[model samples]
Target: MKSVLQQLPESVLAQILENAFQWFVVVDKNSRILYINEDYCQFLEVPRDQAIGKPVDEVIENTKMHEVIKSGMAHQASPHYIKGTYMLANRVPLIVDGEIVGAFGSVVFRDMNDWKKLSSHVRTTMDKINMTSHEAPNKLYRLEDIKGSSKAIRSIKETIQMIAPSDLSVLIEGESGTGKELFAQSIHERSERAEFPFVKINCAAIPEDLLELEIFGANIEPEKHHRKGRFELADNGTLFLDEIGAMPLTIQAKLLRAIQEGEIEPIGSNMTKQVNVRILAATNRPLEHLIEQGKFREDLYYRIQAITLRIPPLRERMEDFTELANTFLQQYILKAGKRRLVLSSRTREYLQNYHWPGNVRELQNVIQAAVYLAEHEIIEPTALPEQLKQVRKKPVTQFVNLQDAIEDLEKMMIQHALQDEKDKRIIAKQLGLSRSTLYEKIKKYNL
Candidate 1:
């Protein structure tokens, strides 16, 4: 037996689909909208032509047609909100010759009243959650976003999962470029306090005198512009204090009192208010050294350091470079609207060998730069930053024994550049030698 779609011409088939689906859309394999019904267009307050060829995300308020097409799986009775109304939707792959060619989506509701009842129920739950505006930060990164399999990163994730449920104050210690704050936020997201607001402030960024006012709420004597302090805003939630080592001694005493007593006195107010906030602190500085120097209070240090987690820098976790590079490549490629891109073997070696002082953050930036700068699908060493190309040329120390010194210098430079700038041609050019001569010297020197 032939199906209606199989028997009818494409022009008649499209008209039949438009009439049957009232609120419907069809997308290509790439998740680009190919067709939208007049009913959906009327609800969208736009013309049918306007919605076509745009990505599904831009076309629909909350649609999963793209995911359905990508995974070749049908999603039925999925909750999707449109124009502030709750709706149930079905998205199925449009298969051709047993191959997924695109996706078809339609709204599923008994009537308008059915949608209203469901929407009201969901809204009640949302009101109870009361998610704050600051809760969802930039790029919406979480634990899964770490994208590394190195032992150091694995341990960090494990430790965070273990400690997140507790109400203890966590002190995150790491170098400037390491993702200390990312781990802290992941902890907050996994904890029981997930429903509450998550606020963040950098201690180093605020002035010493203004830091106190920032912690405790302040009322500016101006023409009607007011602000809430961190404690008040973060009540019953998590407050992330970044660069905690730079906090003033006076502010530290107040912060310690607040942590111990569960209360805070807002600036310009005589009364103190109670606030129940989980504190997550981060620092790149040495608190112990500050304590010894009489710059930091021991009591406050102990209060905040109930638990300490140290993040390993990228240089220490080159084993994770491959995954990290690919993760960044895919991310940038999607954003750039380009096809899949890959790093050459030599480029990968360069990434693995370079000392990333700025850690994961630096690698992400370098890759983002490479995605746009690299001319071909395969990223070559020529596509990397000039600093990476000219690395290891500056000697760390002076050497004696001219012939031995030259050999040692060559070996040191090669090793230094082995991970991040591995093209032999580039290496030869940097060292002022031919490719064959460079290989001969590497063999002679056993480097």
Candidate 2:
């Protein structure tokens, strides 16, 4: 006897499955996507071709297909969050001749209205609870919040995923506005300490006199009220120390002892307390240079940098500029209660040409300002900040004389050849010029 699936034609079977389930996907034993229906691809906003052959988790957020494959257990009517909605999904291991070969998954929302009604009810219940609750939820950034598809961004995200599961101390290095704090939050969110409090303190922002008290709380002199320090407050959690390079040498020694011993002694107290805390430190300045100058402790630097994650500056990842700019523009537009606005070609050109010294933060500020300044649907160059408009890639100077143009081209070629080849003979040979002529041109152009 043939089963119903076997009885039906392949095309007919595929069509039935595609229409029956709102989203469907299949992954191999290795957890690489083998097949995904068009509906699922459309819902994910990823092209079917692009999604195929990728890891299931990379393609679908919060997917359990891999777990299904691993455990060979079927999950029915499980709530899975995708994008912004909670979906009822089913996952089952695919078996052939009593051997598990892969996994099959589907999100079943037979009636859109039914899902909408359920969602509305859940939202109302949550709203009521939130209104009565005194404690507010912590605003911690997740891995997805670090937006960018550039190679550098992807590499950093992959590193975070690999390191976040461990209790290793991480040193995040980047420019002033490269979203170091966001990355720190992402690490905490992905770590085992996610449910615990995530404490943060700026070493540069606090005064030296009170810095010790801030990190290791002080007992009140008159009342002797015992206050919890950041280390104690973040016990069994994560503490992010921003601008760690600016920490005074006096405090650096204490920090080293605390990290090394997993203990801290509060100010005005002789007793020491043990706390299980994961430390994540960040600095815009090079700690090595500071160490050479005797401003930072080398021992402390070694302790914190169990792993280092360097965030690329915005200027280095210009490929992501348009997407980032648009994201910020939309965010500010919604805040201002305005309709959709897009950057004009000229405005984009100006933004792309300028060197973003302040990095992602500066780009966000620029877009926020443009959102309000834009009079129409399109943001013109005039809507951008004055500095961005003024500091553009210098326009190519036009050559008037043929001799001058030839000399300019020769100089550029010789400079590039010299950079590639250290030997003058090799450079001359590469540039197809005589050694004497190359030397003359090099002296003339001052290469």
Candidate 3:
């Protein structure tokens, strides 16, 4: 009996092969190139004519594919990371009757945009929830979207990546709106239990008596049907407890019991039910301070803080300020149905000087509010918050780095020069630097 593929006509087979995503190629037993698809050549950044006569090794830079062909074994390969981009390819030996006939392979480039699309789809479909806005895909949180380029932020991301797949408990510490929950979700999404439910409960939102019942489930009388709590719902998955510091000291004992003993006894029921749940907790308050004040239990703290991660605030990582500002601007402009707007030179200066006490969430809200209020195409100083407009003249000796201090002085001088002359060339000549150098310094300091 012949397979359906083998039963097809030559023309039909040719059309099916041409339209396929996986590029196919055939090589003779002697390892000479015989036939190749248009994509196969295109993937290698070579012409079809150039690829047809060349051997697999000659066409492809990596010899892995060629080795698989000669060995008469099928090979599966993922994106070959090159120049900060992932590229994928696969090679398989073609067998006919009892003889090794030839080899075939396929290749494709895995761009950042494509990965974002795939990640968004996976996040949406697996969670069956609205993880992000429908308008943009790349806006979904990544290591780059964390609003920080500091070594601390990079270290936090690296730690999360290392522990995301582990079952150990994680305690994330950060200020309010510093994206602690976002980090928790990223861990859940990357872990082995990604397909399982990710349940979130705010410890501060629930009363002490109700918190236990909410987590450990409650029993109903024989007359009524009962409901299960988050633990049961999130069994074999993950439960993110936000504001863990806000949990009552009394209930903390129960939580410890549940953690130590994998079973939870309901409020009314005497029997304990086993639940397998991974706990990911976050808090803004300092647990050590609470421990000193006798508000937080030290035992429970140690239990939950098997691994701790500190998320840096926006002010600490100023290098990411411009990137985050531009991202939020693009986001809210489309959402608010306003004309495209870019931050003016003055606006950037105002943003850089103003301390972001509210972190990334505050920045997002500011952008949305500014975009909604702006009448012009470009965001001006007037469009900014009132706090930003009140820039105070402070002493400049705070910077320890003299070079940075000099740049700051030069920027202030240039701003003053611009006000008087209104000419960049004149300002450059007066500053005793080239026009290109002046422009470069202006951009570097975001003057």
Among these predicted structures, which one has the highest lDDT? 2
Worst 10 residues of 3 by lDDT: 132-141
Candidate 1 has a TM-score of 0.61
Question: Model 3: how large is the Cα RMSD against the reference?
Answer: 14.4
Give the winner by lDDT: 2 or 3.
Answer: 2
Query: For this target, which candidate reaches the highest TM-score against the unseen true structure?
Result: 2
Q: Candidate 2 regions off by >4 Å?
A: 1-136, 394-447
Residue-level lDDT of model 1, residues 1-447, one tens digit each, is 477558888888767887896588889999999988876764554445557888888867667887898799898766665543345678899999999999999987624334445666555543433454245345334686565655567788888888999999999999987888888889888888888888899999988888887888765666533467898888888999999999988888889999999998777666778899999999999899999999889999998989999888777665566657766776676456455577887887677667887888888899988988889888898879876765443223354557645655566576455445646678888878897887676554323
Candidate 1 regions exceeding 4 Å error are 1-90, 93-139, 222-226, 391-447
Error of 2 at 431 (Å): 36
RMSD of every prediction: 15.7, 13.0, 14.4
TM-score of candidate 2 versus the correct structure, residues matched by position? 0.62
Cα lDDT, model 2, residue 94? 96
How far in Å is the alpha carbon of 241 misplaced in model 2? Answer: 0.4
For each candidate, what is the lDDT? 0.76, 0.82, 0.72
Candidate with more favorable, higher TM-score: 1 or 2: 2
Q: Please give, for residues 239-348, the per-residue lDDT of candidate 3 as tens digits.
A: 99999999887778888898899888777787889999999999999999999999999999998899999888787766566657766775665445443576778887
User: What are the models' TM-scores?
Assistant: 0.61, 0.62, 0.59
The parts of candidate 3 lying over 4 Å away from their true place are 1-147, 222-224, 392-447
Q: Which candidate, 1 or 2, has the higher lDDT?
A: 2
* True-vs-predicted CA distance for residue 168, candidate 2, Å: 0.9
